[model samples]
Target: MQPATTAVIALHYQNEVLHPDGKIRVGLDSDSPVRQNVLDAASAMFQRARACGLPIVHVRIAFRPDYADLLTNMPIMRGVAASNAMTEGSWGAQFHEQLAPDTGSPREFIVKHTRINAFFGSPLEEVLRIVDAKRLLIAGVATHSVVEGTVRHAADAGYEVLVAAPACASASPVTHQAALDSMSLMAQILDANALAQFFDELPS
Candidate 1:
């Protein structure tokens, strides 16, 4: 894909989600290889995209301390408030260093979302329009949640979606594989290295 028509969306690469010391890491069963060094894979993908002049949009999930902005309709959503996991302005909610955006950069956009699907109630679509991007490369933590959610939405909305499987994972290897299998129907599944090779083939 050409740089001008493609963009990368980095999702939930936050301390509360990706870090070992994250508050939400307690009892999380992410021992799978998919979760290991996952951020490094994503970071390298970002570097390649940047080198190709592809814009990146960083999406985060956070809420007010009072949970005023959060809708607790499920166990996971309730857990966030109960554990104070994704409180806005908290250290846990901050983006992880490996994939954090370079703020003030013209091509990087930071959007805060309150839903599983990044586009729902978020400025993601508007950001894509701003960048004139119709194809997306997505990498995020909890492959079954935010990644699958966003991929499904983007596919249905007529966007060309590619999921970097190596850069994504869920709480379990089983869950992560299942999600990737399901997403393969709607999106192209590529590893970070393959994606880099594809990007390199683009004409200068």
Candidate 2:
């Protein structure tokens, strides 16, 4: 629970995923309370982590303008291709304004991933290593996708992982809760207040 031993990874907080105007919003419930809760919780967690000096890693999913890195053959990715979602350097690919890192902050790290699992083809692990992170505090859009995928991988990689429940959302509440249930087997699940308490109790 020590701040120094932990890094907060905010995943896919991009305009493409979280904003109402996002390209993928067509496939998501733009008015879902679950989604809003996740956004609010994640924002609060980011603020708390910054105040506590915890390393913050922002993980986003993006691809080349031509989407050469994307698997267009996959059904999910096919939709992405049709919508041109999360194209690198596009407005939709940028992190949501509220959760974006200050460009001048050396402590904030941004990892752009092209895959579902943040670690699959990204510098996430390397950045965590640079911060001496032994545990990861994770939150993001699509609880059933990136959140679940990353939690399983992180657990197998031997990092202590905690999922801030309210900070994760999915297109459906059923899927969201289901993913949370399944991920609990591998990661500790906490709400935002409890996560904040973990930081507050850290030894000074």
Candidate 3:
């Protein structure tokens, strides 16, 4: 039998505040935009994936209510601590509306903790196995962190990896491209539109 079809994995995309310094501070501050270019690509990718009947999974990064573990581990959580940032009930931790609808009402979402990689402490692999997903189409923020981490882990896990080049961003354009280049050998880098086209052409 043919290998299982692709499943789209969108990572660490929260409804967040875009700081003037370009870091996402994570909250419903005035810095928030209803949408951004990267999110636009993700929305389009989701629609295309659903239309093609491909499985869709969204991964979010969040912390526990007390944040006791993250504070003990990363400590950066304290430096950036806001009541909203990374907290489950806050607007900052919520999924962007566009991606939210696709992940809910039918599809399921997997949540991760402080780890940059989605699979590090999450049941993402189990979910993929449940769906028999073969390939992953990835998109998200802070290309140097969550995106980079997931790409490396997914490759090591033997999953076919595809990065949506335009559907991701980092603190800067230079770092973004650098991460892409570093992972290029390990991943098939493609634009979101190209990924959509590939799924559209999948044999039924």
Error of 3 at 110 (Å): 3.2
Question: Residues 1-204, candidate 2, lDDT per residue (tens digit)?
Answer: 232688888888889988888988524766756556667788888877877788899988888998888976667788888988889889999988888886677678889887789999899988988888999988887888888999999999999999988888887778888999999999999876787788787643
lDDT of each: 0.85, 0.83, 0.71
In candidate 3, list every pair of residues with a backbone clash: none
Best by lDDT: 1
- What are the per-model numbers of colliding residue pairs? 1, 0, 0
- Tens digits of per-residue lDDT, candidate 3, 60-146, equal 777666766464445545644553366767676777666674434344456565776889878889888877887888878767788
List candidate 3 segments past 4 Å from native.
1-4, 17-35, 71-78, 82-84, 103-106
Runs off by more than 4 Å, candidate 2 = 1-3
Q: What is the lDDT of residue 177 in candidate 1?
A: 88
The best-first sequence of candidates by lDDT reads: 1, 2, 3
> Candidate 3: deviation at residue 11, Å?
0.5
Error of 1 at 204 (Å): 5.6
Question: lDDT at 159 for candidate 3?
Answer: 92
